[model samples]
Target: MLVSLARVASESGWVRPIVDGSDVLEIAGGRHPVVEKALAASGEGPFVPNDLSLDGQRRLLILTGPNMAGKSTAMRQAALITVLAQAGSFVPAARARIGVVDRLFTRVGAADDLARGQSTFMVEMAECARILNQATPRSLLVLDEVGRGTSTFDGLALAWAIAEQIHDVVTARTLFATHYHELCDLAAEKPRALNLTMSVSEVDGRVVFLRKIVPGAASRSYGIQVARLAGLPDAVLRRAREILANLEAQEPADHRHKQLPLFEAHKSAVEEALGQLDLSRMTPLEALNWLADQQKKLR
Candidate 1:
């Protein structure tokens, strides 16, 4: 547990107290202590230098950026720094002024716990609930990918509500990282709540992560490029693009929205048509054209 705690400390940096109405968790230039140390023993250039700080007027920091852009690492590093500083050790950062937190809670990512038979998402909610129930004003909570198990609206609703609860009710310092860029709007009302983002660059169709943290939410998540990076097949990528296009054209999910019923009706019509099709009488080429025409009509 100590080893794990130390690693967490190295990955997350410190959360300093609010000074002059500006709350900033100061992080001076430092490599990922654990990650860099290992790479150095094998002789490699270290990660870049960066600084980040948040004030009381900004009690919460929402992080956004493309996958593998070091958003997760930076979030973890900030949290880790807070833990180490509170534990009375010299932080991995060159300088930091962390508020004294009574407890440090984190829900970083969902992973299968086969022994417990819980789905990855279920485990995520369970950890979040623990933080909500137990965290105090002096606590520091780090959450990553909250509400990832469910549909878009469901996930966004849950994430929004949880952040509100932590800020309005629990009043704990929070670092929330999510793919839902929409949540950045919360900063408008929650002055104590702010958005932070990681930097990214493209070179020869490849992504390079700057690993630096800056103020404000990101505008894009670049899911397709990340999917390509994961080795998604060409056909699958094409299909994903089509689905994304359709979703973008669709209305937002809300109780007042009537588009969902329209979509369902369209799906039902397609199913009926398929059921009634004379497959034995049609040529393969004819069948393919028929399906394509049907799909086009839905759009």
Candidate 2:
């Protein structure tokens, strides 16, 4: 095993990580090994490398970005490098010096246990509960889109509270990726929390993913633009843009008191119309028809 690791490291230009007993993590130009290898094999340019710095003082990172911006990739690479160092294998990093992590916890993606009658949100909360109860100062955590399966306000509240708990109590090194851009307010409230974002750029009026993690909160989720890129019907994209603008106009000044779900409390005619939609099974043509019906109702 040792011989094979050495050979791979030599071939891949990997570096030796310093795994001394410190309570800090400092990684320079860290790359995801599997991704780098795949990129090389596929001739898909080069995998972008990123740096990470975490310690007792600044252990929580709030990562916000649009979809497919490489937030999960960055989080996975950091965890893999630390684990590889502990396993006595060279890591894919220019330099690495991290303490021994007692445990590694991750809560990313979505899943459900319908056979057992557990909803997606229930499963998400259960895994999050495990992290909250078990993780410690020496633990490493990677979380993504916490509280996303629920309503907007509910999700924001839960995500905010969980981030606070992790920073104040667990004190673990955490990389949290979320769509609730409101959570970025932690930089002012929590001294130990830092905001980071996956960088993207606009080229020729098109969004180009830079695949680099930079310090600061993202201004927007860019969900509409991303959806358009995914080839959603033109009619659907137009309706989405309209709804987004309406919601933005109604959003509260304080992010914590976010607007309630569109169909709750004060219902806009459009939202009330959309609320009746069974989007899960709706065909594009049906969706277009629904939108036409809603527009006629408004008129």
Candidate 3:
């Protein structure tokens, strides 16, 4: 087994990762070893190499990208590299610096354990509970599409809460890949949260997956294009497009508003006060008075 490991490492041009004691992770030009081997056997184009970095200030990566854009592959490779390094094997990367992880947790794919009488969402939540309860500051977690088995609002809410708990309480290094673009908001408020997405481009109205990780969130999921690629009937696809448009049109322009209770009543006075406030020109005293007035109105 050792010989085979060494041989594959040499053949694949894998590198010995630096086992640093610091709470940091750095990988440069990382590629999925299995995918690389498959491409090599088929004489296809080389895999695209992408870089990843996480540290004390930026420990959680919220990865958002379109379906079939290699989000899962990239996240899995990170965990795999850690496994290889701890097992005394070279990793598939140009360079790597890995910290010692006490525990490795992954919630990647959906599977129901029928014998246990648990549904897919039940299994997902069970695993998630374990991760939340067991993972520590030195643990590594790769969670892909948590809370995806439920309604959109419920799923988004659960995803948001899980992310916050991991960031604020567990402080574990995590690679979270999701179709929920709204989760990207965590990066704005949390110092240790960062956003990443797989690069994609359009060529003559067709979607192309670049399979390269880049900074920032993806603008859209491109689900319709993926369904089209899956050979869905033209009529069905057209209907789906229309329904998607109508749903999106009903969504609030601000993602934050979506979190508000669906039946919450809007206050015209509060709205008017917000619109009338000119923060740039207001003095501190004036600002205080305005806030007091608004507070009184609410009462």
Candidate 4:
């Protein structure tokens, strides 16, 4: 394995990363060796290189982009480079400087523990819990799609809380790739968190994956475009587009409600309903009926 790795490093022009004891990681012109080799074998043009820099002040990256836009590839490459550097091997980058990590944790991809009767989300949460509990300030963590197996609200909530914990509590050097764009808000709240996204462009109404990492969050996931590329039936694609448009149209109202506190927003109505309740004179059956009426109003 060492000999083959050396051969690949030499043939592909990989560089020797500078391993240090400080809390900093910097990579310039980094490429995934496997992907580069595959592209060379297939003559599919040169791979795009991206630069990453992190330190004690910015220890966590919240990466968001459309599916298959190289988010996962870039994140994996960073982790691989870190591991190679710590192992005293050359990494696939023009330049790299990585701090020594006490532990490396990766929560990527999805699978079920069928033999143990666990669902996909259960497996995902189990791995997530392990990382949260074990990761420390000196650990390196790469998490992709951390809460994707659950409902949108639940997934976003989980992803948000996890990002906060990793940033505020664990303080690990992390690369988090996720489809939940709302998680990008962490960059604004946490000094140690930053946002990154894979670059994409459009030409003649078709999406093009630039495969380049850039600062800032992606505005949309472009799932329909990806579905179209995957050759989904035209009828289904059309229906999806329509549904997407309606959902987007409703987003403003949804966002407004999301911004409000649930209890505070409903306080006036609750007070009014309570004012109508004659609790002192009400019978047990009357109280039950009033409770049922209030519950129906809530729904």
Candidate 5:
């Protein structure tokens, strides 16, 4: 796996390695070295390098960044340096010094094993479980977008718990990438943890990624920019804006209030509507009023 990481990093041109203690990882670089290289070959500049260091003081580093801002690339480059160093080959970085690791675990890039009849979420959980069960103090664990397979609250809860375990229980050198900004509070409380993020800029109402890693927390993820970059239809983009407004206006998931399932609420309304249907007993005028009331209720 480390070899694979190195090959990808070598091709990308921007994956530079940094050594702080016994750990070896790339500084600010792309996520998948292979993919980054391909883009560079087509004349795109590589992402800006961010600050990544491993001092024995902090074993777990939390990476926070907007989508497509190079969090994954940074993760991949770190893994690649490990592979290159172990193979006794020159790495793609300016420098590197590696700590010995019994095993390197990555929970990035998960998909369903359909041939095995497993759900994507199940596969994700399985990978996470593997990390939690096997990681040791000397291990290097990279987890990307954990708990995205479930509801927001469930995912956040799982991410928070997993981070806590990785820090307090496994005590491994970890790089955790997440959209859950709320988890930054853990860094405030834990001495062995730190928060870092990719950089972004705004120009003429457009956002550009600086790709630099800096010490701090991410403010927001421009999901709309990512969607537009993916070539979403204009109408879809407009509707998405509407949906985002509604989502944002809703209560935050971290709040104590319980959430109701939309599908279950819809089903309950259907059942109630069915029970209200009594054609035999209703006069025409009364039936019209009842229908109108039901329509209002549905709305």
Candidate 6:
């Protein structure tokens, strides 16, 4: 098992990882052993390696990028490297170090349990609940494409709350691969969180995957472009691009913009007032006051 990891960093590098004392998990130039061999056998281009750095403080990594951009691969490699490092084996990295992990938990793609009468989203939530309940600070979690099987707002809200719980309460080391670009705001709100994205390029109106993971958030998902690559009809692709432009104009790119808690009191008061209001019974003063409160909350 420890003999794994190559293309990016071979096991022959022999950088034995320290797992007992340090409050960190760092893997430089890590790659999937299976993927490396598969790519080599297929005579494909070189495998792209990525680096990971996590510690007790900065433990949550919010990974965002387009579809088929290697986000899942990067998360899986990080987990594999951690497992090997803790097993007292020379890791497949230029260098590797980690605090001993008590348990490793992962929730990948959505799945359905027919025998259990659980839908895909239900099964996903069940697994997530278990991980959240059992994982500790010393544990490592790899979550991929969470909140993807449900409606946009529901999934986004669930993902947002789940991320907050892990960052504040669970405090587990995590590599979360998601398509939610707004989650990059986590890096702003939480001191222990950071953002990562897969690199890509736009050349001659086509998208190319660089397969490299780097710091920072991606601006958008290239689903339309990918569908074109997948051989969707040219007319369909053109219409889809038009619809995408319309949708983008419908809402701000950063839909869930981050704002400070400076208006907490005003916000609470406004919400409470709105919840109790009877529009038909409102006086002139009441209308004026409500408008003023709404303006204050906005600011």
**Best prediction by lDDT:** 3
> What would the C-alpha RMSD of candidate 4 be, to one decimal place?
10.5
- Pick the winner on lDDT between candidates 3 and 6: 3
Clashes of each: 24, 0, 0, 0, 9, 0
- Sorted on TM-score, best first, the list reads 3, 4, 2, 6, 5, 1
| Candidate 5: regions farther than 4 A off | 1-36, 252-299
RMSD for all candidates, in order, please.
Answer: 15.2, 15.2, 4.4, 10.5, 15.4, 8.2
Candidates 2 and 5 compared: the better one by TM-score is: 2
TM-score of 2: 0.82
lDDT to native, each model: 0.74, 0.88, 0.89, 0.88, 0.75, 0.82
RMSD of 5: 15.4
lDDT tens digits, residue span 127-156, model 5: 889999998888889899898988887888
lDDT of 2 by residue, 60-81 (tens): 9999988888898999999999
Would you give me the overall lDDT of model 3?
Answer: 0.89
Query: Which residue pairs overlap in candidate 2's backbone?
Result: none
Clashes of 6: 0
Per residue, candidate 4 scores C-alpha lDDT tens digits across 10-50 of 98898999999999989999998889889889999888988
Per-candidate TM vs. native? Answer: 0.71, 0.82, 0.87, 0.85, 0.75, 0.80
The predicted structure with the larger TM-score, 1 or 2, is 2
Per-residue error for 199 in candidate 4, Å, reads 1.1
